[model samples]
Target chain A: MANIHDVSKAAGVSVSTVSRVLNNHPYVKKEKVEAVKKAIIETGYIPNINAVNLKKGKTHLIGIVLPFLDVPYFSQLVQGISQAASVHQYKLVLYQTGYDEHQEKEALEMLKLKQIDSLIICSRKISLETVEHYQQYGSIVLFENGEDTPLSYTFIDHYACFMRALEYLYEHGHRKIGFSVNRLEGANSSQRERAYRDFLKLKGLPFHKDYIFKKCLNIEDGERILREIAAFQERPTAILATSDQVAAGIITSSSNYELKVPRDLAVIGFDDQPIARAMQITSVNIPLYSIGQILFEQAIAVEISHKEVSTELMERSTV
Target chain B: MANIHDVSKAAGVSVSTVSRVLNNHPYVKKEKVEAVKKAIIETGYIPNINAVNLKKGKTHLIGIVLPFLDVPYFSQLVQGISQAASVHQYKLVLYQTGYDEHQEKEALEMLKLKQIDSLIICSRKISLETVEHYQQYGSIVLFENGEDTPLSYTFIDHYACFMRALEYLYEHGHRKIGFSVNRLEGANSSQRERAYRDFLKLKGLPFHKDYIFKKCLNIEDGERILREIAAFQERPTAILATSDQVAAGIITSSSNYELKVPRDLAVIGFDDQPIARAMQITSVNIPLYSIGQILFEQAIAVEISHKEVSTELMERSTV
Candidate 1:
């Protein structure tokens, strides 16, 4: 029921000041902005952005397509997107693609039909070529796992991140090191595999085929891998996991074999998740949250290009 | 650019079969569904639903207002909603309200102005009265923590759930029991506290005000609370924590004080999260994913009412 006039009157500011604040224009005094915010809250004023969107033929809704939620990796990325979207005064629509091409097609359709202003593909099953084709319809930004795409992307160097983890183990006097990965085919895992092989070769270490562990997704994966290692006659002294969950699993399950981490089998993990800290597993801290924020920021732009976020190795008690 | 007819012809079925398959209609034979699916993929067909949405004057967008993501509680619920929404051909727009009244207001305004078809308040800062006020503008289904409001809600009986936990501990020959809750003022926690006191009095056990713990949101909260309890000369022999994260924290931190669970202090947790399983903490499984599915299914409907999901006590090693 309240209007700009009521807000301005309550805040003791001019109507133009209120307008500037609502439109998010710069150069407004801090005290005046705070006053306007307080007054808006007190008066319960909601500026009618729908009217503006209607006139501009824009819904001001951005679409984000991803596989799933609840996983800390994707959820943290989404959290960053949520924060950035709210700041920009834009709403985000999440399409749970779940690696299904049909579900992904619906998200692309939302862009082509002008239902959403732009599309940010966080994860997808469709090939790069298919997504590149949708670029003509609207801005399509990606969180790419590998190299640069034809369209705009935020790239994280999985190869470099994994390499850092391996080098850290080698520097800590580890000779025989094992590797754990979630998927063998994905861009991230593919690059990580390359890094593992390359790092071992460069360091003049023997490549143990049995040390290569795959499908290490959950904590069970870590435990499963550790159990296999415990039984093997020639087990590696160090391990690099694809996820913090896997690392945490190794720590908890290691008790069964009387293996103390760093003393018996040093372990390094990817993703600095809370579990990693709680379980005391060192990891390659990827800037996934920042990547989400940066990608969303660039995705809404009229013209955009590739952006890269680097990963840092976190030192902890594990190694 | 293959159409429905081409997909049907390729699959050896009529256009209706292909259409139904594309629309995800139930009752289709398994082989027929697989054949049609293969045909669609083979033909690279994409169904055009934009025209249908335009003609029906519907956006087919559902807004989900939650406090945050990355936490298992909300993330799991959103996961369920995302799965159900996709099945029903609706897109979810996320509003990470973060218990901010202004952010929640933005979501409510989205409903009032028809930006989204309906608003699903997963968590909110606004009172039930304010939400009830918005009911006139559009459908508003809530994930309420407290008592029933005038509007529809998907209730998880926190009081009954807590009462059951207390009774279980009492049955196990535990006279002194402590309680851990996140928010003290919310409806769920308030009811939980009342149940705790009522159950204690009924069992002729003395109520110790010092045993009540608050602000137990994360694992650290559990650890901090356990540290406080360790110093207490008259610490309870048992604890019922509101979350599994907190319970895990207590267990891990207890080792520092030379304490063992079940023998030293029995701990029962709420929410059967993965951490509970990893740490072997007995907890009340709230069936959050099903709650999400059922809530979203009802939130999209024209007529909505209150629905309650029961909790199950999962007996594990800790208890």
Candidate 2:
């Protein structure tokens, strides 16, 4: 196996100069650093980063823990976080927990084990109290919802966002409206549900728990939701979906059932994703990419206490 | 400030037992393992993983480099890779390069710097020759269109897949068919283009470069493609979109242009994602999730060989 000595000999540099370049020390000359890199490649040398980081007491790795990656919302967040972290020269290590508490615990273990420098929690099934204990290891930035006492967080105000969706449906002469969410008990879903109930009560319309659809995460879930909506005797005239995928599914499935959107059943979708824009589905535009960007920035910057990412309503033909 | 002594005392175990549990020694008692974990949480001890790995010479971190995470194809691949890596007890470090050569180079740097144990390049703008020299550092698995010497690669036969898509269009009695791709000169795109021209020649039809649409990555690009198709003085009767998002865009955009699928413009998309299933769009089923699973498995398996995944045609509503 080739070593630092071989790299130094091949590059015609001293052993210490090769060491400095491998350590990412900025004081080394650019050409010398380039030569060392080329020599290392030619010699096929491995630097033993574990040994280097042991001496330096640091690892430039940022851990991002979330439920899913295939979904549009989380993927957008991942993209934003990856870009922001890359700008800071930090790599992202993902922990896709998928509502499994054990996986979430393993991610926290990474922080405690010094396997990563900092952590960004996009969403967690674990309680804030459980995650708070690991704050001493590194900066843990929460996304979507968290208390501001011991850690920083970046999230949208979902209650207000849902209120806008509800208001838009009401203005279009739709009194009986339904909605969809990924989970019934998640922090964001509960907040939106609260908004749904309060808005209906303020307008003196009846709120039915049966009208809310849970366990809808993808387009398939959205398609299944249509059947449930159709089965309701006192069905809604319009629906506000928690995601664009769900709204898109309903619109596409509506054709199969001879149900035309707006003319037969008005629709409002969340996330204003590309599909939403392409289909002209009225939506609550949560800046998921910006939120992901802020999550990484705040986690790495380690300066802010808390921040709120705003969501706007994008009105289109669907409603 | 918590140390080994504190953990030992707190767990009511000897210092040696704590060390054994920390090292993941198999002979350690189960209850002692639980106690040590509990003490770890109680004392908030931050284990120096760098020091431990320095002696063992293993990081157990597998690097996964790709273009984008928000797109369906890449995200599905990410999900599969993450799941497969998690099962193997190896964590994935993602470098979402987004077509940036510098970022792609940074991923290669990680292997040389010993920051990652191995690398799985999902797709790259970097040449295979440039990546070939890094095989000595560790296993570097290429995702698509890689050589079968000194490195392992897992890829689908895009040439065959595109030919099937083209033949399907031709057999349906459509003489003219255009296609969309993310990049014009990509290894897979160029192969598909060659397949397009070859199939046209075999059928005694002239190939037109104007029928091809390049630089399409998302649904918005598909929407834009509709306008371009309309502007064509002699447009194709059908389209073979490279991705499901682009296909969704074309289908959705068709409504605005008063063009009906199959009747006016038959469309076929690649990647049988949830969006395709929801839209009932005919597509080429590339097992992206399985390919990602195989990428992680092969990169870690460390066998010196290459493999090819197969694709299928899903006939649905659009075609």
Cα TM-score per model: 0.80, 0.89
Error of 2 at A118 (Å): 0.8
Best by TM-score: 2
Q: Find the number of clashing residue pairs for candidate 1.
A: 0
Per-residue lDDT of model 2, residues B201-307, tens digit only: 89999888888999988999899899998888897899999898999999999978888997999999999888899888999998888888888888888577688
Clashing pairs in 2: none
Off by over 4 Å in 2: A2-45, B1-45
Scored by lDDT, model 1 comes in at 0.83
Residue lDDT tens for model 2, A89-134 = 8899889888888899898988988889889998888888889998
Per-model fnat list? 0.43, 0.93
- Report the lDDT tens digits of candidate 1 across residue range B161-243: 88898889988889989988877876678889999989978888888998999988777888888899988999889999879
> Which ten residues in a row are the worst by lDDT in model 1 chain B?
B48-57
Error of 2 at A58 (Å): 2.0
Can you tell me the CAPRI class of model 2? medium
DockQ of each: 0.24, 0.70
Q: On residues A1-319, what C-alpha lDDT tens digit does candidate 1 reach at each position?
A: 5777899999999998998898788999999999999999999876544444533547778899988887778888888888888889888899888779888988897887667888988877787888888987778988875244667788888888788788888889999999888668766778889998999889888888999899887777888988999899988999998788788788878888889898999998888987776666798887777888898888788776777788888899899
Backbone clashes (count) for model 2: 0
